[model samples]
Target: MLSVMVVAATLFSVTTVMDSVETSIEKGTARLGADIMVVPAEAEAQAKTALLAGEPSTFYMDRSIEDKVRKVKGVKAVASQVFLKTAQYKCCSVGNMLLIGFDPKHDFTIMPWLSKELTRPLGTDEIIMGRGLTAYNVGSKIKFYGKYFEVVGMLEETGMKFIDNSVFMPYAAMKKLAEESKHKKGVKAANLPIDKISTVLVQVEPEISPQRVAIFIEHDIPGVKAIVSEQVISSVRKQLFVLLRSILSISIILWIMALLLIGVVFSMIVNERQREIGLLRAMGAKKSNIFRLIMTEASILSIMGGIVGIVLGGAFLYAFKGFIRSSLNIPYLWPSAAEYAVLVAGCLLLSFLTGAVAALWPAIRSMRMEPYEAIRRGE
Candidate 1:
């Protein structure tokens, strides 16, 4: 019973983490708010890496591509964004933050959500922060490239580290910063790369196929690669599935070993208690009562073992969540209280069933034993 509970708890924890991470990633991808992303052909891998790592990175292409993308057939809307990599210790309270520039007039990605949080459009010198940014809050001021900006709003958690850890500002503000940086002393102003954009976001018309639009953008646009949001997410899902399969395979093997060990242990226990069981039968206890007695003992042991296992497993998961996420390179969100309650109940129920099943044959054999013959054999 103890072995079974231990293996079951470990399996449960692994599956729960994997499921939570996969779900969070899917939800975060959906909230990205773009059907397709267009970036310089040389920057595709770096862009994906930045997205996954939630780190500041700079990659740029000609800003003119935005106009070409907007003119493409089936294009409903096109927004251009610039990525600025902040210095580790200069012009910012926090180090190595990613600064994103969005066009308020043309953006569909952040504006719709930003509108709900703020009553007015973002000012040129004001910024909205992602939830994962801990250093600044509403009304707090942050410096970027020697320029100061106030945090006007903060976005809700999106579970994607890239969006959650980034800071968003108006494109005009970023442009002004870039212009000022050229003359500013002691700053890496040359990194700004004026007249270039980091990426272009496209929203396809309702009747147009996103995949087709992505292909069109790739062919029509020079020096750029077009990525369909669904395809990118599907690729990520496939990678996660591979990890899940490996975990599941190991868990199955452990579970089978646990079950076999538990069965053997229970059989020995029943054999050792034969005299006591035979005595009970001789004293007017029915066969059903003997069976129930043995089953009840198994249930109690299973329940105790399960409780211990759950405590150990839950503690381990809670204590090492951050470490686990970093080590595994996966995003994870803890289950809500109600969801955890369900998981706990499931573990207990599975442990109980395993105990009952493993003890079934032994219990039946005990019940069918002749009292005198069993007592004699025991002596």
Candidate 2:
């Protein structure tokens, strides 16, 4: 029973964490809102890292790339975005945040969701906050690049750190900040080139293949690499599958060892209690009674062990979740209360069944033993 409990608890906890991480990654990728992202060749790796880590990164290519990409075959539309890094200071209510600039006319990524929040297009000084921006509320002002902007809307939770912790504003507002910072001595914003952009988002025509378009852009464009969204997501999924397979392999080994241990323990108990069983049978107890007694003992032990295991497992998962996520470098979201409860119940039931099945052979042996033969053997 104890072995079963330990193995079951470990398997449940590990599976839950892995599943949560995978789900978060899938949802984050889906919400990226671009078919293909065209970034400077030198910045391709950094861009992927920033997207996965949910951190702010700045890398730029000439604005002329947008025009070139727009002219590519099978291109439906193209938009340019810029990344601006802010500093953490006393005057700033929100800590360091990534400021993203998008063109309202050509943007299809954030504008769809942004439009749902606001009745009008984003003004030059107006901005939208990500869900993770807890420092300020709607209608509050945020200071960035030595300027103040009004927060007109807030994005819903997407579980992706990049989107959740970011601030979105108009491309014109980003340009204005760049111009203003040129005269502000010692400001980091002045270092950013006004005519450069961080990324180019492409929307391929419905009948056109995004991968083909991405390939075309990569081959035709110089100093830029185009990435298809599905390819990136597939790579992430493959990595996750490798990790999950290792976990399952370990879990299966432990489970089998547990079953064998439980079976051996039950067999030993039955042998030591042979005299007691014989006496009960001599007093007219039926074979079914002997079987029931052994099975009942197994069930009780299993239930107790399962209860303890579930509590311990839940505690461990809750306590070390942050450490686990950081160590794995994966985002995690805890299941809701109801889902956790179901998981707990399922683990307990599994443990109980395992214990009962492991004891089945021993119970049957005890039930079939003759009273006189069992007593003689015990003596």
Top TM-score hit: 1
- Candidate 2 structure quality by residue, lDDT tens digits, 256-291: 887778788989998988888999999999999999
* Model 1 steric clash pairs: none
Cα lDDT of model 1 by residue, 1-379, tens digit = 6686686678668767766776667666666778888999998888777666675788999999999999888899998999987877575566688889989889777756552467688778899888778777788988877778998988766667778889999888888887887788876673677788999999999999999999889889888988787786678778877887787788778767766777788788878888887788789899999899989988888777778888888888888888977876644556667767877888788778777777888889889999987777777
TM-score of 2: 0.81
Task: State the weakest 10-residue window (summed lDDT) of model 1.
Answer: 110-119
What is every candidate's alpha-carbon RMSD to the true fold? 3.0, 3.7
| lDDT computed for candidate 1 | 0.80
Where model 2 places Cα greater than 4 Å from the true spot, the runs are 67-79, 88-96, 111-116, 183-192, 203-210, 237-244, 273-300, 337-346, 370-379
